[model samples]
Target: MPGSASPHVLLAGVDDATEAVLRTELGGRAAVRRLPSGEAVPPDAADEPTLLVVGADVPAPAGLVSALQTRTRHLAVIVVTGRAGADDTSALSLLAPAERLAYVRADDPDGLARAARSMLDRLALQHAYRTAQAAAQRRLLAGGEVARQPGEQLFGPLYHQVLIGAVAVDAAGRVIAWNRKAADILSLRNDAAGRSFPLLFPPHVRGDLREHLARAALVPSPPTLFERLGDDGAAQTLRMSAQAVTNPDGTTHTLVILEDITSSTETRRQLAERTSHALLSGDVAAAMTAGDPLRQRLQRSAQAVVDRLGVAVARIWTLDAQENTLVLQAAAGPHGHLDGGPSRIRVGDPGVGLIAAERKPHLTNAVTDDRYADDQDWIRREGMAAFAGYPLINDGELMGVMALFSRRPLPETAFESLAGIAGQIAVGISQDRLLDRLRATTEALQRPLLPPDLPTLPGLDIVARYRAQGDSLDIGGDFYDVFPLPDGQWALTLGDVCGKGPTAAAVTGLVRHTLWTAAQQDPDPAHVLPSVHRALLRENSPFCTLVYALLDPSDTPVRLRVTSAGHPAPLLRRRGGRTRLLEEHGPLLGAFRATGHPVQSTVLHPGDSLILYTDGFTEGSGAHLSREPEDLAALLASWTGPSDDRLADRLADLLFTDAVTRWAGRLRDDLALVAISAHP
Candidate 1:
């Protein structure tokens, strides 16, 4: 025998020479066993045979060839035939019924050796193919069974099929079940199912597993990808996804899927470290400039990260507090339109799919995968190939999300860098909110220091009002002053500085204090106007209008001397219900250095009223007036009652309420009103 392993040859003829030749070729390949022409084959030999050689020249019974062929069906059969046409053709027809059979010529020694080698090669290939197929079928069956079983019974077969070590442990760290794969890896074969997981794993990993398991048991939807230790002493990365599986009896169990992703975990850790370093290199301080410059810097930072990291698209979404939606703040990419065109996403909806709805990080490597089948339309519309979203949480609240998109699928490791970037964005948003609150507080504190109260004078009912223009951060420049002069007469003035806010407010204070002080020295309105004008001109300021007046109630005409410094004309309402615009005025203050312009005089009878106001009141394009002078005159003329609290209230309503309605609830300038009326 060629190999002496096992030789089972079926010899049809009793020729010694032919048998010896066949025996020589199969010597070591198999244990050469012979079969007679009329002898029945052993049943065991029929199922398992190393070799089978048949002689072609021997004639057999009618059913002999069919019977022998059936017996040796499982064995390899070789036919030794003559080179003649009839023998060759007949042997070929008989060979069709037998598998693992080859024909060789009787005179050919090389052909027999070649035939043996060929049959052996075919057997080896068939064995390998069967082995692989059997293994695959076993895995498939095991996986299907695990998938169908209750959660408590699923862990064992799943780990075995995946060839990954796994053990299901309860919250108390006791193992409920362990798979064969775990036994192979950990070298623990006996009683592993009921043992404590902590005894098998390291203390730290055991603690982590218990903590994660506890959380999963309590939460409605648990987090996945928890890290755990492997059987090997070295750190073996694991991803644990848990689902709450409830039985028919209402008993709940945590179905944990354990995946060994050591290489992927290490990649994520390294990438996160590199991303942190890269983000630290960004000029965060420089990016937080004021106004449009700040927006530009922020855009550039986002663009730089996208470019350096090879992200197909990057976007920043900010929370709109009023609208209660997340609006796209900035985005950059070739398909950046995904973030454009009403980029507001409702918090409760599945904006960009479930990622925004859950207010947590969502990652998908394949947009067309079964997990994203429900959101395929949205993904296709956005041209999304792969997506990752991380919530931008500030103070534990979801402010928005920072998302990255790619045309090609990215590994899970890519999201760690983006999550870190989202954290940074959250910090920035929190800081901005803090600054805005501080600014509002500062503005509120400054409001009390403005024009506090109007002074009270005998024989005159006076009303003063100051209102800030539309929700602006700046303080107003309007001021009203009432002080008693040395002559027992009251000097009153109302004026508006050219601008609004702190600078204008400062100028208003200066002009008000100067007028009060100048009026005390010279009770005449004309003299007070020139002194204040010269003081303002010395400061090299622009022109400001003022109406300064001295009122003496004891006099017959109520002795009023009024001076105008480029101010609106005062309205005079008589007791008979007649009103006129007092246009007698001088140049505005700060126009020249005390030009000696004379003061204009106007008399007020008892039961008459005088009104002084800034341009804000008359500038209103209301139905009452088309211009400042006309608005003032018409308002005064309409008052039928005595000028008392009711009249003052009416004046305030006309200026503020009526004008706001006319201007569509917006104010273009600060408004100030001062009303003085003679008592009956």
Candidate 2:
């Protein structure tokens, strides 16, 4: 016991000789104190060591020590009665159930001091068996150490029922004591006293608990936790820690603290799921939107897929003409010599090429398996354990192949999600290419039917702009023409057929040619319109609506001779911004033979514009479509376009700018706008 630290000790039932001997021999070995009376030591000394020494010189206590021990249930008592065996039963009865009582017979300084040290050492061993107080617990319980009493407690009532679930278990994993929260969290019925630790966790996760317990015992200072499922079938994530403690009889014990983290774990899992769903939705949106061209759009889509699925690389390879080779169109993410790296593969080549050739999707969790043994180098260089490749097709023809690589093993759903996005890419690429072909064909046919450039007529500046309906074949029933007439006069006409596409376009061409040839015979708007209507009377399937006007400067103020074939009336804005409508009414073309398409005349003042437009603007089924006649008149009146060169195109764009009801901003019908402004 040399160099042993001193413990707080209390002495009783001894004369001045014992007190002097204890002070001299036990000096610097223990903190010794004296009680004025053996039966009545201070109430605070009940928790400390109280030794009753009956020396040969000092008379023995007469049942007073037994009275003191009866009052302190947790006290340690010792006797030096100068006798042995059953003779010292009086002192043995004063010890607690788990406490040891020491006895001695010698009365010298060494003998008395040995007796005192033996009693203090037993009490100190009992305190040492307790767990190290948590720093947080010590901060809450006490700061400065106070004098130890016989029964004074350190762990007060303030921390007994704390929120944390605390349990004390033996070295055999049998529970000893647990708080109410531990009972509730583990779904224990009544008491957790005798239940084993393995019963608290599900069978599948018991090994994890065992491992944590073993590791915790090896290094008992710091605590650790493991995840498991509890008896309630819910995901029960418990934080566990164990520290080695000792019982009063020199047996080892374990103290554990369990914190329930089931709610936090569930929250994290749900958050990950929601985030993945949102990212998938965004990827679909980016692919479907027509904000970029086909190559760039497919590139963005592939990148989105790679980022969302946490894959290493993704690429879209389009099939070439011979269908025997695949061409890389877009690539994203990291792959050595793969991202914009000028790499190509034949149709039956390894990886993406084979997928495209067979028009089937391919997925493998282990790329290094026997089937892919030959591709080990490629797979290892990509650093991916899983790979997925999807072939993109439109109708029955293959469009492209999409291949993705991942460093982690992927689930079946990753392949399904990749297939879904591949379909979108296929549609986007096909539609864009089809539109390009349609646009080129439309230009070839439209050049001969529609006017390439308006004829330059003195005293008038004319311009026109056209927009076809939807992404359909660019050819439509809308048409416009401006041609020069005899004697410094100009002729302009705007018209719309009953239907769209090829049949209507044929009628449109017939109408334009008939109007021009009839003008050659007679340059009169009133005379030529009836001839054109008669020419179209035999065609009942496709009819035409038209507004024709002839400008003549024979008199001082120019004259606008206008004729309508069931078309929207033309508006004429004067020099002072006042608008007037030449509202001529006539039967629709092809409706009746020899129809009277009367000419309504209007005089064009200087700095004026004559507006000829189709019904696409007013009759469009959109929120801002202006069906009212006054809306057209107001818009015409506000045009200061007699001097600006971009007047015609600007007015056409404004017509549909506020009325975007279609999903793609395409017009429900074709738009043809032609503006003839009188030069200032």
Candidate 3:
């Protein structure tokens, strides 16, 4: 109803600079009206086909766009903006459906005018189609069978302008008539009239096409099928639907309709691929990071490849450099078993071993037909067709080999994806192997450096927890110790040496032993900390942070002498669940000469607790886990768990769990926490 007359263009907020340009470009093709920014759309504007061009500067442009869309069925909208990236422009662009919306930059007046003219042309086409539909309906109601004609006039203008390809064929499957859309969609050569419809399709599908046409001519509700045409590299998906129609003379013809759905089909396929890649990467990373043996991790990764990629079989092999042989490390799927012969292959052997020898990928879609694989009965039995074998190379060194077998031919694109997946798994395997060695070395060093068990002092309960940075291969230097001193006093120290690896570990040992010896000679932290400071400077070791607390448990409420050197202040949680920081600061040890060591003394009353930790407990990737002192203080005050033997363990667990969650399980530095709670 709206397109029954000439379309109207309503330009709102057209600046003076671009107004004349727009008018000249529009060429008086449509009735144009200039509406000020302050005015609302006219009440009668919705009565005819309308196009609204609103500027981005208009107040509440997104709201206006929504109102215009909902109020009329035949209105198209264009939003002109000074810049594409402006906030208002983005809001207006996304306010309406893409087909009914257009956006043009204000500086490009010609572009805006072109968009307006295009929309107007579309409106005219719709009006013509609607008019023809009404005339056809009228003729049918007036008994038109006696005077009906053939060809374009009989089908009316609507048939020629419609989007889908349409063809009319006789019951014998010979093409009688077809719309222009059919000729273009099918890439017809010369003339299509009097041609056999089935012959136009691929030779392989011609017989099936004939059968489908016959079925459609006989059935009232015909079936539809999707056919792929063109070369393999650039194929298109055509959805074909057929229906039987009777002419005025009672002759029946089968009407074939085709709609190109290549874009939508490719979109669905790409979405599936992305989902698969994400799932595969997650699974492989999870398996590699788990506390499992190398073989078990490899097995999990192999199973994931099979499950995610839909491969019939997947196998992994690791190279034994000593023997120059590749051994089957993991296998999954129907034929995935390592107990059989050829579990070990020499580097120069054929098939999987050859891929490793050359350090290149081997992809084939004719595994069962290849002469080299003809001897394998399983390949024939399983009807295996496609094979992809990639050498797992990391940093130019062959780590192993990964191979998969499939019963169907995989597209060329799939081989590229599989190659990339193999490379990812290779990197994961290499990292996991390195982590194994690091774990062994770190565990050995940690066992002696950190006190296996804190000394149990009278009226004093101490617990400490330590975790190296997440996914780190280097040894950490975070250490904690609780040792006894003369005069019934106890020395508790938590420290983080600068840097990592062997140098840091060496400094950690020196600091621990020096603190123990110093506290024995003098139980005061002020004297003990300075002595360790001198020891670090003498060794020329990296600068370190230390928190040393000398506890005299003989008193009713433990008298604590605490000293901090370039360390995070310790939290003092009172008996009533209130927490505060004991702020004592000193220069970093081993970094400067003549540095003062400051000490603060506090009494830990019965039912009170003291928490000492390294900076890693608070600092992490994002703001959520950033070093916020207030957040840490509040967290300590909210603790409701018991302060018993497991008090320190539970506290460390809570803090570490929260840190891991906020940082996404990837800590950038070593984390250590020590909780000392006085027993009632």
lDDT of 2: 0.67
lDDT of each: 0.63, 0.67, 0.76
Residue 578, model 3: lDDT of 93
List the candidate numbers ranked by lDDT, top first. Answer: 3, 2, 1
Query: What TM-score would candidate 1 get against the native?
Result: 0.39
Q: List ranges where model 2 is wrong by over 4 Å.
A: 1-304, 322-327, 334-340, 343-382, 394-396, 411-447, 485-488, 553-557, 592-594, 622-625, 639-667
TM-scores for all predictions:
0.39, 0.57, 0.54
Instruction: Tell me the tens digit of each residue's lDDT in model 2 across 547-602.
Output: 88887866657788888888988877776678777786788788766578787877
Name the better of 1 and 3 by lDDT. Answer: 3
Worst 10 residues of 1 by lDDT: 147-156
**1 versus 2: better TM-score goes to:** 2
Worst 10 residues of 3 by lDDT: 145-154
Clashes of each: 17, 11, 0
Flag the better candidate by lDDT, 1 or 2: 2
Q: Which candidate has the top score in lDDT? A: 3
